[model samples]
Target: MKLVIVMLGLCCYSALASAGDNSKGKELFQTNCAACHGEHGEGKHGVAPRLAGDASRWSLKLFERAVLSGVDDNGRKLKLMMPHWQNGSFKGDNGNAPSKEEIAAIHQYLKHPR
Candidate 1:
């Protein structure tokens, strides 16, 4: 019984780690990121960089750090306009920050562009 429970726990964790729903990701992206990144992530000229191709290359860790830390993988600060969602707010957007799992879904969506 203990072994079975352990196996089940491991399976659940693995599933979560690998899971990424593009549909849900689209919704989240539209609500949270579209304003700056553009409707299809093509980006706003000189405001935000295109994320479709660029973001897909980022590792999950790097993506998560950027979302939460407002810093690039190299630890350099992003543009001042980029908001840090780690503290559950994006530049005073009133605490509307996505959880890590949601960000994973967004990552998956970004990786597979239409």
Candidate 2:
């Protein structure tokens, strides 16, 4: 009985689903983002950003834009608050950005974390 139970537990743990196992992205966010972005994904009033939704607040493509180029979705002056990602703006404190493959993982993690 004890052996069976142990095996069962191991199986269940291995079977656990990882939503977009974007650990790197998640870690990165926690380190570099949690300050402005909320720990639970909730956004603050001003300081940094609220990444839950509100693409229009900046722009739908702003994430990619902000990552690659310094332009906000609206194509206005770059806000001083948002740092340029390419300029080594992201310190080593956090994990690196998600790759294309990891986007789904990151999204899954954000949408549903284990």
Candidate 3:
């Protein structure tokens, strides 16, 4: 019985960890991503490409990799200015880097821009 309880508890914890919340994503994006990417993801002319429609087409895995590693979907390395938010290890003056779950939430929010 104790073993079953532990297993169930672990499962619940895992589920909570994996779940993504778009509201949180929006907040993170506003603080972290909006500056370069634009508040509405419109992109800054030549500064940064538009991510509103583009990022939504990417798979979650690829999106996570790009955000964490500063790589694009085409395997090209992004500019140095792009910060790597690997596992929430991204250090910057503006805001928190974003955990894996937060990345998921960002992806979800990007799917449908407001």
Clash totals for all models, in order?
0, 1, 0
TM, every model: 0.72, 0.54, 0.71
Residue 32 error, candidate 1, Å: 0.5
Instruction: Say which prediction, candidate 1 or candidate 3, comes out ahead on lDDT.
Output: 1
TM-score of 1: 0.72
Error of 1 at 44 (Å): 1.1
Query: Compared with the true structure, what per-residue lDDT tens digits does model 3 show for residues 1-114?
Result: 999999999999978765543577777777778889998677887678888899767999899989999899999998978877763543343455557777877787887767
Residue 19 alpha-carbon offset, candidate 1, angstroms: 7.9
For model 2, the superposed segments whose C-alpha errors exceed 4 Å read 1-20, 56-61, 93-114
Displacement of the residue 29 alpha carbon in candidate 1, Å: 0.4
Per-residue error for 46 in candidate 2, Å, reads 2.6
* Stretches > 4 Å off in candidate 3: 1-21, 87-97
Question: 12-99, model 1: which lDDT tens digit per residue?
Answer: 9988766643687777777788899987787899789888888767999999999888888788999878877776753334567767
Pitting candidate 1 against candidate 2, the one with the higher TM-score is 1
User: Per-residue alpha-carbon lDDT of model 2 for 1-114, expressed as tens digits?
Assistant: 999999999887766744234576576566665677577456677665555554323432455565445575667656766665555445562546434433333333445332
Model 2 pairs whose backbones collide: 20-105
Best by lDDT: 1
Find the number of clashing residue pairs for candidate 1.
Answer: 0
* Weakest ten-residue segment in model 1 by summed lDDT: 89-98
Question: lDDT ranking from best to worst?
Answer: 1, 3, 2
